[model samples]
Target: MTQYHFISGLPRAGSTLLSALLRQNPAVRAGIVSPVGSLVAAVLKDMGPDNETSLFLDEAQRAALLRGLFDSYYGALPPGTAVFDTNRGWTGRLDLLARLFPDCRVICCVRPVPWIIDSVERLIRRNVFEVSKIFGSDVGGTAYSRAELMMAPSGLIGFPLNAMKQAMHGDHSARLLLLPYDTLAEHPQETLAAVYEFCGLPPFKHDVDDIAFDAGEFDARLGTPGLHAVRPQARREVRETILPPDLWARWEGASVWRDPAFHRRVAVGGTPGADHGTAAG
Candidate 1:
């Protein structure tokens, strides 16, 4: 049987890198955001009261249909392969997932909110000639406006962050393993070992220094060329902030997972010591 797990959390965090590294394990299958989550959502919507034909369906039928989506999508994989479906929406759908795959776990990659914004800004600046679809149809906007847009409740960064926070405080929090971006970048080996342990899988040697991943076509469609690209080496690159000081200050301490109280509520990976002190920037 194929084991199913999930990868979710804030954008611009280390999900792309995590996926790249996980793929190094021959028994694992992972990649950039998959459409499976959205398909699951569509199936649920179609089975909801809003749909005229939904009244004919029972809980068992609905569950079977949902499970079939995964089986069909990954049917070609060998029976024992572990499939890590990447989607930010997964955090919010834990209730449904619990019913579908009780033993599955979600690995949420997170980072300081300010740095997330800065990373997106950096990408926008690097691709100056192309107006990113990240901003929708708006072709022009200042840094502040762009920040405000992304910080909206349903915006790219906002939705996943909110979903993660909700999951952290909810009943399914135990199924989540929060991995900080800084820790993964700075300590790839230790992070991967922890991830394997969390998933109950035996460890596999990974060539972290030669990690490779890119989603050029997907990124091109978004008008953001390198959105899902991962550098060959897995190491943190220190750089000065490109955001204005005031903008940086606005979001600097917004990483909720860094809070001591957060560790008390759920399991966290990559932090040093038993107390789970703040992760390095």
Candidate 2:
């Protein structure tokens, strides 16, 4: 059986960053999203009058479509390597992933609700046009409201996140690791050590002794291609401006960010792997 680590979370909770870090380890092969599925769905749009794609595709065709998606992703990965895919709102389809890889370790990354909302708001302000260029008609005709997107019936971000939490509370806790974003921000090495253990990977030695994790501008040199490229300044703006002051209270009591040590890191530049959470969902 292949070992797979599923980085499941709401958008803007640092799934990209976490996936990038995990991918750096030689044992892991990260699977990022491709535009092929959406692209294919769009070209077939004219074929249907209403939302009747199901009528076009027979049972075998439907199965083939899903298979193409899986194959497109898995075919790129090296044999015997653990695969990691960091997609938001992936918890709802947990069983689907389980069937794909029987041995799976899920890392459900989470941030405070307020911060996540704020990040979504920022993404709406800046990235909508850029994202739409790729997703195009698949994203819907008119622009979507961030609030409505968050509370969508399909569980866009918040509710699905809560569902993940509930799963952790149930029988899945042994396989599901609830990693707070704040915890990672403060002590990346320590937190990542725990994650590596959970994923059954050998821990790498920590080189930086006095390093602090800062979500500020990352190293321009450590180019991990598309995964590491995120707008941290935009993230900070949303965290400071968009999220209401009231919401901070909910996370302020938590041990990671609320505690003095973590606060100190936030006040100063944090450690080696410091990451800024972006507004994306």
- CA-only RMSD, every prediction: 3.0, 10.0
Deviation from native of the Cα of residue 194 in model 2, angstroms: 1.0
Q: How accurate locally is residue 107 in candidate 1, as Cα lDDT from 0 to 100?
A: 93
How close is every model to the real structure, measured as TM-score? 0.94, 0.57
lDDT of 2: 0.51
lDDT of 1: 0.85
Q: Model 1, range 223-276, lDDT digits (tens) per residue?
A: 999999899999887776778888877766667777767653443443622221
Model 1: ten consecutive residues of lowest lDDT: 272-281
lDDT of 2 at 16: 62
Model 2 segments beyond 4 Å from truth? 34-72, 96-100, 126-145, 205-228, 231-239, 244-281
Backbone clashes under 3 angstroms, per model? 0, 6
Native-to-model Cα distance after best TM-score fit, residue 114 in candidate 1, in Å: 0.5
